[model samples]
Every structure is written in structure tokens, then in C-alpha cells.
Target: MTLSTTDSVATAGTAASEQPRPEYPRPDLDRSARWLNLNGTWHFEAEDADSTITVPFAWETTASGVNRAWLERGVYRRELSVPMEWEGSRVVLCFGAVHHRAVVRIDGSLVGEHTGGYESFEFDVTDFVVPGILSELTVEVEAPADKRAIPHGKQRSIPRDDYDGVSFTPTSGIWQTVWLEARGRTYARAVALRGDSLTGFDVVVEAAGDTPADAVVVARVLGTGETVELRTDPTGRAAGRIEIDAPRLWSPADPHLYRVEVTVGEGESADTVIVTSGLRSIQARGEQLFLNGERLYLRGVLDQGYWPETGLTAPDADALRHDIALARDLGYTLVRKHLKYEEPIWLHEADRTGMLVWAEPACPSRFSAEAAAAFEAQLPALVERDGNHPSIVIWGLYNEEWGLDWDIPGSDARARAAEHAYETMRALDDTRPIVENSGWSHVRTDLVDWHYYEPDLAEWKRAVAAMAEGTQDEFPVRLGPDFVVDKSYYASDAFPRSGVPILNSEYGEGFTSLERAWHLRWETQELRRHDRFAGYVYTEFADVEHEAAGLLTADRRAKEWGGLVPADVNADTVIVVDLIPLRAGADILPPAEPFPLVAHVSHHGTSPATVRLHAAWLRAGAPADGQAAVAARAQPQSSTPRIAVNPFELSAGLELTVPAAPLGGRLMVWATDEEGDLVARTFIDAAEVEEPNRRGARSDG
Candidate 1:
């Protein structure tokens, strides 16, 4: 019997409510009509196992509300009565994503089965549908944490902490959206864009068919206010060379997307589909990344889609938008969504908000021949699904060499599998950059990636700077580390370059460590100069179980992971405008011993200015001594110009002159005049500049 419409997690299947409709299956095509969101309560039962849980979101996630063990085998059932209008057309069942193995049956009849958890697969269900009553649809899904040769990133067999080297909670189950789309026989299968700084753009339309060989194809470029149409040859394939004069390039700053709608056959016999895209080029020249023929710096952060209540499945479109918005607020223009794929709506919002995206496949723990083949097959579908989103410019194939650990005996097979996967992705879609491996190991691919953790900012900078000078042969590999500055490997002399643009694919792991674990307080960007260091991700977006490395708490509350803050400052609070004093053509200051370089600061506000010294900036790279002090030359809050001085004269030997400011507010002062503004100043004076102040931890004094 097919399971149908039940609210309980254990027995719910693919009911209408279980579909994620708001994701807008077609983002490139504009439609003002509303569709149903089928992502909630459905009837389910394990065909071979014992229990049923929520669909899409993993069984282990809090969103399922099950908190039970991962089900290896299960039968999911739901009911959907098609509208009478769709009588002649075929009914298609579309699964946004399913884990490992899946078999679908309609009206108690076997329909089809698909293998692979990360990519979406669909089948026609028109033959199995009844004319007027509610038809039953059952989907049997099997996901065994088997270790074979699949491109699993970091997923493990059981929910454990040892995920590669990351101590994060385990992930399992569907973990994505599921839905259905009813369409005509000859619909658009895949739409791709290939462009560059030289040739402009070439649109490739891949289609499915068994129709007559004389089918005509047409592609229309939908611009701001005009549409350019191009016709293709008789083989149901089309290509258009578009030369946009001074094209409005798509980047994090201005994401201008061009819409393209293709139609096959003449009016009465035509089938049309729309795909949205942006015309731009991204390539690496040595260690510099060029976007639209200019050196582009990627200011990004790691975004793991999770929620306190929803876990993997987003609560609504707002949740998805919130992630991009938060990243934007933290001065990040790009987001490297780690491991898991997001709902289409997430990419839609990213496109809308002009945020750059680095998309990665979900981390798979088990590997096998079936898994590899399944993975390879699903790549085109994945490209088809998110290709319209201009925000996604990079495709990451492997992360930190996690599941495809090259140390094993079958490592060559797995490595070949990963290479083939990335190669196939390129074959299917070559508009964006493809990362072979995210960290350390070289896979002889388009982009070389690496991971490192070093506390020595000076050393890291020097190494990267040397590479910028072309002392290294290969381009600079991207760096993804757990911490911004790792103390242990800080001064190590090992800096390897394999010829690629250097971007921080990962760093800044935890922002909430201040409250949970003090030792984990190295999640801030104290020494990161945006111009020199390029860009980096601030740990994570939310706290994932034991991994408290999030700029936001598990419940979506904001936390400070990097030094960057929101541009919109509270009118009532003192706004600390950080203005760096630098000389023309001056090199970065050499890192001194582990001591705090204190700057006596005083700000003008309605009342006394008080700042909370978060421990993030005080770890590792900070000075060892703690004797620095700020004093005023003129009275505090004075508009008159005067040099500020350090009370302890710590900056006496520094390049610039130091003066003291008159005192206005006490330590952690409370200001008056809620609306009034005050001018404040500070001075640094000390025999020696001590390390940044630390709370709870032992002091040098």
C-alpha cells in the first residue's frame, strides 16, 4: 500500500504538502502566478526498515523532529489528484534530491528508480495516474553509509565528531527539496552559457528527443528592455554568438542577468522554456583572479544552511534571504556554501541580491561503483537546476580531500572518479570555474585548491607576497583553514604553490567560542587587510551542534566572527569608524612578538563611549604584554584638534606622533543625551605596548 497524507514523522510520505514549491522551479522565466509549496507533513513507512521521517531534510536533523537513527531502507507514499486540465500531457514526478537509492511506484504500479543522493532525478507518472480521484505515489529510498568510490566530501557512517578533521555533527537523509513538474514531451533539458573577455558569449541548448529530425530550434536573448532572437539548425540544438558592446558585466557589485527563452517547432507545435543567465568571464592569470578582464577579489564566508528549528530545510524564503543578507551585512560579497546544496530559492535570492556563490556538492560518506556512476549522471541535472542563477560562479568538486582520502589503496580510483566528475561538469557547463580539490592535494584541474591553518599572520603574508612576486611556479592555491591565524603552524617555512588564484575558501570557524569555549577564540579577522589578503569566509553562518564557529548563533542571532561589522550602525550607539593610518607605498608592519598593540581610542557620542573587547582579536597574534593605556591631550569630547598620547607612552618609538586626550567617559561609560553627538579622542603612552587585554585568562601582570 502507498503511504499517504499523515502528519506524524514516522509514517509520512510524498504528500502534496511535502513539496517545496516556493523555490520557483524556473527562476529565469517570470511568472506572477502562485504555486503550492509541498514541503510539510506526508505519510511515510520504511519498506525494509522500521520508521518514517520528514522528507528532504535529513532524518538526523532537528527539522525532522525525529532525532532517531538513519534509516537505511524506507518506503514513502503520498497522494496527488491531478487537475483535469492536464489530462493529455504527461505527469512528471520531480525529486529535488534523494539520498543513495530511490524507487518510485504510482497507483501500486512500479514507475522508476534512481541512484544518487545529491542530484535531482525525475520520471513520468502520467501512465500511472487515474483520471479523477486521488492517485497514490510511493517512493522507496535506500541510503546505506557504504564506503566505496563516490565523491563523498565529509559525510560519515554515523553521527560523530571526527568528520575529516572537523568536529561537526553528522548529516544524513534526503537533505533537499522534492517536487513535481508537468510539462510537454519535448521540453528543454539543459541550457548552458560559454563566454569570455574575448569572444563575448555563446549559448548552448541541450535537449532530449525522439521527435522528427526536422524540429526547428530558436533562442531569444532577453535583455533589459529588448530581446535578441537566434534560430538553430535542424538537430534540436542551438548556438548564438552574442557580442555585447561594453556589456554590463555580472559581479558581486552589480549582478546583471540576461534572460534567454528558447522555443522549439512552430507556434502550434512549439515547446518553450526560459533560462536566466549573466554574460561575464572568470579566469585566473597566475595568482590573480580576473572577472570580466579585471583582477577581482572575493570577499566571502562559509555558509552552511541550518536552523535551530528547521535544521536543513529552510523555514521559508525569508530564512534563505536572511543568510545572504547576513553575509552582506558582514562585508562579504560572496558566500561559499559548504558541502550541502541549497534550495533553488537560495540561489534566486543570491542572484537578486548580487551575492557571489561557490556551490559544492553535499558531502557523501560512502563510495561505490553505483555511487560514482549515479554521481556522474546527476551532474548535468545539477548544472541544469542552478545554471540560471548568475550568483553561482564556481563549482567545487572535492573538499579537503575528505572522503576521497588519497592515502587509501583504491585512492587512484577515487581520484580518477573525482577528476572525471569535475571533467564531466566542465563538459556539461564551462561558464564558471571548477575546483578539483578544495584543500592541500593537487588534482591537475582548472583550479588548484589547498587548506592551511597558521597563527603567524606575518609568515602567511610573506609567503603569499613572495608568490605574488612569481617566486613560485604554479598559481596560488586557495586556502581554507579552521582558524584565521593558527599559532602552531604560524611560522612554518612550508608554503606550496600549484599555480592558481589564492582565495580563502575557508577560515574563521567559530564566532561563538567566546561563550562556549574560550580556547576556540581565534575566529576574528584582526590582521586581515582586505586589499592585501584578498578575502576569506568567517567560520560559518550558524552554530552546527558542537561546531560553534558561526557568526550567528544556532537560532539565527548575529554574532561577531570577523572584525567587519554591518554598515548600518545604530543611531543611538557610538559608531566606531576604523580609519587606518598609512603612508603612501608603505609596506605592512612586521609582526612583533606575541604582544598586544594597543591603540587608545575615544569616540564621540551622546554619552560616554563603551566598547566590548571581544576575545576574538586578542588570541594568538596579539602582543604578550598587557600594559598599554589611552590618555587624552586635550579634554575628551573636545572639538579642538590635538595629538592624543598613550598614558604609558607605549608608542613613543613608533613612526607617528602620539598625544593624550582629555577624559570624558569612565571605563564602560554610560553616556547621556541620547540624540546628542560628542567628539572624542584617545592617546597611547607606555614604556612598552602590551598585548590586548584579556578577561578570565591569566594576565602578564
Candidate 2:
């Protein structure tokens, strides 16, 4: 889920059954029964003014119930009626989010406006509203036509440039829930939760409006099981701490959360706000990441957080929960929410279901003063709003130096900008690690991660091995107009690289689903076999338009990996086999002697995983007199007479003989766990497609 939030949408400010998103949106800040969902239907139109699009789904998407060209600017109008009983309270109109920018007005009069599409915003419309009567609420939204030079993230940088492979279909206008709430004149405007699993928790409440000078704030905390009376300061802020006698750590295995309720006063006139958070600590020491003092690997996937039918919005709230479940099923501990401010409910689900996340913001495509300001604007909202969740383990600022023109290494200003963003994020929340620029061009970053999409299997393995050996710094990773392909300067010439965990934040670029699966198995096995890399994130979890590197389709269906299982490849304990023919569809030619196949067990589990090691080598159906050279041989695949080794320790090496069948076919390789499960598998065509020497691989000596 991208940084998207939802609100219950039952009616146009009335409790009706026809709303699309009926769940109360702000699970992070619950004020009981004083809110009304405004998510059903709104007057929507672009420059042409011919359509009525849905509120939560973008105008271009099919789920929006409209079919038209997506325009940059759109307007939404609705008439809201507030219940007479809630007249004495302050009426606040809230929006889960709006794309790019949104301008609010009541009865054709300006109320307020908000910029930035990913975070939530609201306005207190107390004076403008007349209770029990309809009030005209109009929202004018503008998502700039120029996709670049703004924090647009994975959306296409050059508007309708179909050749742009990285960007997906861009969405515009209101794509999240809109609602209204009633609050007391004095209430908790913002609640900041901080602490860890070991010590305790801290609560900082910002009191707003006409809070009495003697108003008392009591927070009935659930996780710590204590009601601490917070001391109010002169600036209308109440701060307190809760100590836990028995603290339970939160992790992917056990995601325990703490419930918080902050009451502003004592009697019936008092107001309360509810929020949820968890306690967990993540650290990196000498090339390994630890959570709750236990070593853990970041088996993460890059998620674009989009759907085919719904451009950027989920059809329903359960889709948010399903994304987390899918990530877990793929054997990933963490999901790097790539480039999009995802759904807050997604973060909530991760908190409840025990999933780690590396959150990122939509990034501008080029560098400029305005772009930097817009890019920096998203940081505080992202950090302050989602900081309370324990599922977020890392904060990512720039991605591959997108807005910086991909020249952070050469340009001091760009490098400083990345470093400055890191400092800004640290100032906001110093609990988790921050990647200055994920993938490469790291001016300042906690993890020395890189992104590569090399399709060559041999080269990929070599790069992975070199990185694991801590020698990858030898290569320069600069990318820009002035960058020379032959340049020799390291990405970080001055910054020290020792002791930091090396990870591949982005990789996996194969041409087809079968090839992608092949790359997945080989690349993953190579990474695990070394056991030196701290972690890796596949290029993506699902395909988005032209970017076909996903292990799953855009609809979340698993892509065929030619019978290879993702869970087995991603398991903490795994078996990896080294093969000469790594490329899919490549054939294995029989040598005069048997070929050597070395397999190793890469286990990151707390305990050793000794599953029964088994292998099946399907020999080609060649004639019995196959002693002759198979340079131009062909054969049928024969699974019979399977080669089995008893208690075969790979340290002794396994020898595989190739016999070409009469017809051209494949020679399969299968690795099984002790429990007879299909832990690992792969295959290569056995015979050469043509006569070998006739199409000589090398000139005669």
C-alpha cells in the first residue's frame, strides 16, 4: 500500500448505507462516533465538464465510474448537512488525501488549501456551517501537468511518454476518502507517540483552541497498562511518560501494539482521541541488521502500490490488508514501499500482522529550487504522520537521485541536498535508519545499497559476489550527462564504507515471466550462497505496465518461474546449487567426463535447518552407445533411472553425466528438503540446437 489513507464514506455527510468506503478512515486517530463519511458521490468535472467521477478513485481509472482523458485540474462539489445536535461543537472537514494540490471552499468562499498528494489534511469549518442545513462544499484540485520537477514518484516523468519504462499510468484529483468530524473547542490536535520495546513510551499532545488554563489531560494507555496524567506546558502542550514493568518486543514474528487514549478534560464536556502504535528497535552493526537485539535479514520487495483497475486507489480497504498478506506469503519480512506515500491502513495492517516496511515518498524527476522544496515538503508529513508505527524500519528520501538529476556524486549541491534530507528526517524521528537515496548515488545513507538490472547471469553473480566480499566500492556508480562510462572515482570517496551492511535495494530485470523466474532463482541463490549480503529487494513485487520485472502480475497473481517457488528461494534456511548453464533455454553439452555440481546450505535461521538433501538428474534419452561425443546430439527427456545419492554432503561434490536423447530436450535439476519438499528446482536443455563444430564457438587454433 502506498501512503494512502481511507475514511468511511456512507453519504454526503449523513449516515447512509450507500457509501463506497464505509470504514472510518483514521484508525490512527479515532474520536469514537463524532465523524460523518463524505465518500459516496461528488460533482466532478475536468476542463470539459462532462463527467461525474467517484471520490476515492482517480478520474482516469475504471473504478471511478467514468471514461475520459485524465486532465490535470478537476473540481468536486458536494452539499453537506450537519446534524443539529452537533451544532455546539467545532465542525471539521477532513480529507484522507488529495493528489498534488487541493483548494477548499464553502458556499463559493475560500476555506483553506493544502499541497502534496500523499498525506492527510483538514479544515475547521465551524463558523461557515449552519447546523441542520446544507452547506455547499467545493474542492478544486490541481495535479500539475508537468509530472517531472515535482514529487510525482513512479508516475511517468514526461507526461504521456509511452516509451518511459519506469513510470506507470498517472492518476489525478481526489483518490482518498473525504469526511467531516465534530470536535470540542479544545481537543488534542496532534498526538506524537515515541519509545521502544525495552524501556517504555512517551506521549506528546498538542492542545488546540480554547483549552482552559487548568485543563487536565489523562491518557489511559493500554500497552503499558497505566493512566499517566500529563503535565501541561504554557504553550498548550501536554507531555508524559509510561513505564512498562514487563515489556514485550515487537517483531515480524510477534507484532504487539499499544493503544492510547488522550482525554483533554474530566467531565462530559471533555474530548478523547484514540491512536495505535508498537514498540520495536532496529539496528545495524557490522554488515548485519538486528531487530530487538536479534540478527535479521531484510527480505524485502519493491512495491509500486498500484492496481490495474484502480490507478492508485484500492477498490476496498481489504485490498490494503491483502497486499501485506501477499508480501508475507512471498517469504518477505519487509516491503520497501517504493516511491509512493502508501495507505496508512496498510501500515496499520503491518503493525497488526507483524510486517516491516521501508517507507519512501513520491520523488520529483529533476532538480530545482521549487522541486527541492516540494520534495522536502513531503518528508515532515510522512515522518510525523506515520512515525508512530513500528512497522516502518527505514525512511527513504530520494530514489536513484531522481530529483537530483542522478548526479549526487559529482554535484556538491545535490549531495548536500541528500545529506540535508537525512538530517531533516533524523530531526523528525531518530528511531529508524534512513536511506538518503535508495539504490545508488548515496551522499548519506545507513545501508550501502545499490540497484542493478544486468540480464547476464555470469555478470550478475560476479557483481553479487564482489559486493558480498565488500569490494564493490571499486566500481563508480555515477549517472548523469557529465558522467563518463570509463570514470574511476568511487561513489563515496570520502565517506567511510566499513562495517555497513551491503544490500541490493533494487535488482531483478528479466525479459519474460519464465526468464524473470530464472533470474529470481539464480540471483537469489547467488545472494544467499555468499551469506555476506545483509539483504535484497527484488526490482518489484508486481508488474506495472511496461516494467515487467515483477514476480507477480499487476493483479497480484504469481508469475510462472518454470516451477521454481519464491518461498523456497526466500526461506531463511535454503539449499543453493551452482550450475554452469545459468541462462534459461540454454543447453548443457556433455563433456568427456561428468560435470561438477556444488550445492550449499545458506541458513540464516537461529537453528541449523538440515532437511534431507535430494537431487534428480534427468538424463537425455540417447542410444546406449552414447560414449560418442554429444556435440551435435539431440534427445528426448527421460525422468526414469533418477540419480539418487544417500546422505550426500555437497562438500564431496556431485557429478552429473549428460547423455543426449534422440530428440532435443531438457535436463532438469531438482533439490528437495529433508521433509521431501520441493525446496529448489531448475532445468537446462540437454542437447545443442545446432552442430557444434559446424558453428564453431571459437576459431581454430
Kindly state the number of residue pairs that clash in model 1: 75
For candidate 2, what is the TM-score? Answer: 0.86
Candidate 2 residue spans exceeding 4 A from truth: 1-18, 157-163, 212-214, 474-490, 585-595, 609-612, 618-701
The TM-score, computed over Cα atoms with residue i paired to residue i, of candidate 1 is 0.71
- For candidate 2, lDDT tens digit of each residue in 1-701? 01112333243245444566667777777764787777766777678675566778877778777644447888887778877878677788888878878999988889999999887888888888988877788889888778677778766644543224567777777888887888777777778887664566788887765663556888877645677887567788887787766777777888888788888865766768887876778887887788888887888899989988887787777888999999888888889988887878888899999988989898888787788888888888777778888899888888877888767778888888888888888898878888888777666678777777667778777877776666765444434335433221135677666677778787775788877876877787777766557788887898887777788898888877664557766776655666645355443554434344455556576544344333333445321111211321233322212223322112223344444344444444444445644444444455544544565467668
Best by TM-score: 2
* Superposed Cα deviation of residue 604, candidate 2 (Å): 1.2
**Per-candidate local distance difference test:** 0.51, 0.71
lDDT of model 1, residue 50? 43
What TM-score goes with each of the models? 0.71, 0.86
